[model samples]
Target: MTAVVQAEGLTKYYGRRRGLEDLTLDIQPGEIFGYLGPNGAGKTTTIRLLLDVIRPTRGRVQVLGGDPRDPAVRARIGYLPGELALEGHERARDYLRFLGRVRGGVPASRIEELAERFEADLSVQMGKLSKGNKQKVGLIQAFMHEPEFLILDEPTGGLDPLVQHEFLAMLREVRRSGRTVLMSSHVLAEVESVSDRVGIVRGGRLVAVENVAALREKAVRRMELHFDAPVPAADFEGLAGVRDVRVEGAGVRCTIDGRPDALIKAAARHTVVHMVSAEPDLEEIFLTYYSDEEQHSARQESA
Candidate 1:
């Protein structure tokens, strides 16, 4: 299938400062591609380049199989910037109406529906809306058109838990309809919950891109088993992928890398009464890419 979004050697520089470097990636249709990074890590820069909000200092990008500068391509994308600027006296409804007219008419009903889902008060002036409310309005505008691709930057920022859940549900609906999403966020839980694949960016460079399942496979899990009887340490000592093994009385403890198939089979040798496993948090997995050495290693591996 043709890529919904593609970038080759994509780099951006601001004077002597780096924005992004050598970012080559492809986002497939109907996939939620989570762009993960901290502040100043170039997530916003990448989004801007994709949208043609700013021209790249080098390399090229294609959005929806065409140049993002093309009006037709731009029309097919819905974007919400990280730092939304709603400095105006116009009511929320009025602002949306004006945007709808410019976008060649988004139905009023659609706008109203999105507003209701986000619990945004359309009657409130744009300048008067609280931070969370402003974010709601931003979300409404982005989803109101129901574009083919959504570029959302820190989409769930300032949202209450319930609304965040609602927004995630909406994203699922978007994917169900065969739409694509490029969601950039530093929040790990949100991305982990919804993204099919994630690209980790650090120091203005792409470190790694992995399927969510693939990432989980790399996670280290700590497991403890309480057996009905003392199991011989010899059983688990040499098992593949099991590390840091400790045997005490009728208990066995170890960290398992990837699948616990070998460990499980080994433990079944004895009567297992109970088991406790602690999965590594996604944040812990993400931090592995942030180290300079690890980033270099990842880039080399990818190459």
Candidate 2:
């Protein structure tokens, strides 16, 4: 499949500080690429560079096989900023209509359909709308055009769980239509559900890019299994990608690093009553990369 977005050695700076450095990646067409990182980690910077909102200090970026500065290339892309700036007094419907018109006139019916689906009160002025309502407006505009490539920065911010699910469903729909989505978010679980592949960024650089299933596997999760009969400790001992195995009476417990199949099949050998698996939270995942980046940064600073 052709790449919808490709960046190589993409670098940016703000004064003496780095914004994004040596960033390189390819987002396949019709794929949802999750850009995972904490705040000030250059997620926004990368988006801005892609949109041509700012210039890259170095390297190259191609959107839709053309320069991002090309208006035609930009027309095929949709974007929502991390910080949404909407003025008050203008009704939400009017606000969205204006954006739609600027983007070549989205159908009136389409606009109304999205408004109702998101439960947004378009009659209210943008300024009077609650934070969630304002977000709904943003979503409507970003998605109304149905661009080929979507770059959403914290797209579901300020929205409730239901609204967030709605937004993700919309994203999934976009991908279903064979469009591409690049979602930049720190919300790991949400992204995990929708992303085909996730790129973990830290300190203005891409650290790891792996398929969701693969990444989750790399991050070992603890699992406890209870069986009717005692499991042969030897059956699971030192199994490939299995670690920290312990036997306690009729139960067996272990942490599977990158493969659970082996452990599962072994457990199935016994009469299994129940099993519990707990994946690490974002904080735990964050510290894993953050600390590594911190050490790398420190070494670079010293050098």
Candidate 3:
């Protein structure tokens, strides 16, 4: 199957400063590809490059099997930018109606369906709507036409927990229909929940791309346990895959790499009162991969 989005040596720069450098990636069709990165890490830069909003300093990209600059190709795409600007006195519904017409005539019923689903009050003027409400409008416009591909930047920002859940459901529905979505988000849970695969970007470079399940298997987890009675720190410090062991008073804290079976078994020796395990997130995953890369480089140098 042809990739829905492809980039080769995609690099961008602003004067002498680098925006994104040598980003090579393929987003397969009918899948939700999550783009993960911290701020100033080039997630938005890559999106703009794909949308042809700004020309790349060097490199090439294709969206939907054709050049993104092609109007016909662009028409098949739905994009929701991170910084959405809504102004003027036009009612939200009227603004959507206009956008629908621009995107080749989306039915009023379709618009209404989305509005109802998001519980968005479209009767209000665009300028008067709250941030969350404006985001709802942005989402409605992006999905109203039902394009073949969608590129969303920080798609769930400003949404309540319930609305965010509903939006993720909508993404699953889109996938079921064989459409594709590329979502760039800072929320790791959002990405981990729906993405089939995730691409990690760091410092303007494409660092690692891995299957979500595989990444989860090796993710770093920080665990804290509070015991009714203080336990010896030596028990946890020697456990495999556990590090940064610190025992203070009746609580023990440590970082565990990959599985925690060994730590759990060791901790069973003492009476456990309270235990909190921090699930690995994008930053943790990136740090793990980055550390691995550094170790490999050091080994090569020693050789």
Clashes of each: 0, 0, 0
For model 3, how does the per-residue alpha-carbon lDDT over 1-303 read when each residue is reduced to its tens digit? 889998999999999889999989999999899998888899999999999998999988988999999988989999999999999999999999998898889999999999999999999999999999999999999999999999999999999998998899999999999999999986577788899998888779878898897777788889999889988877877889988999997899999888999989988998999999987785566667778877987899999
- lDDT at 201 for candidate 2? 86
- By summed lDDT, which 10 consecutive residues of candidate 3 come out lowest? 279-288
lDDT of 2 by residue, 195-303 (tens): 9998888779899887876666677678899988776789889787788999988888888876688888878778899999886454466567678878988999999
- lDDT of candidate 2 at residue 153, scale 0 to 100: 92
lDDT of every predicted structure (CA atoms): 0.91, 0.86, 0.90
TM-scores, each model vs. reference? 0.93, 0.91, 0.79
Candidate 2 clashing pairs, residues 3+ apart or interchain: none
Question: How large is the C-alpha RMSD of every model relative to the true structure?
Answer: 2.9, 2.2, 4.6
lDDT of 1 by residue, 83-138 (tens): 99997889999999989888889999999999889888999999899999999999
The candidate, 2 or 3, that scores higher on lDDT is 3
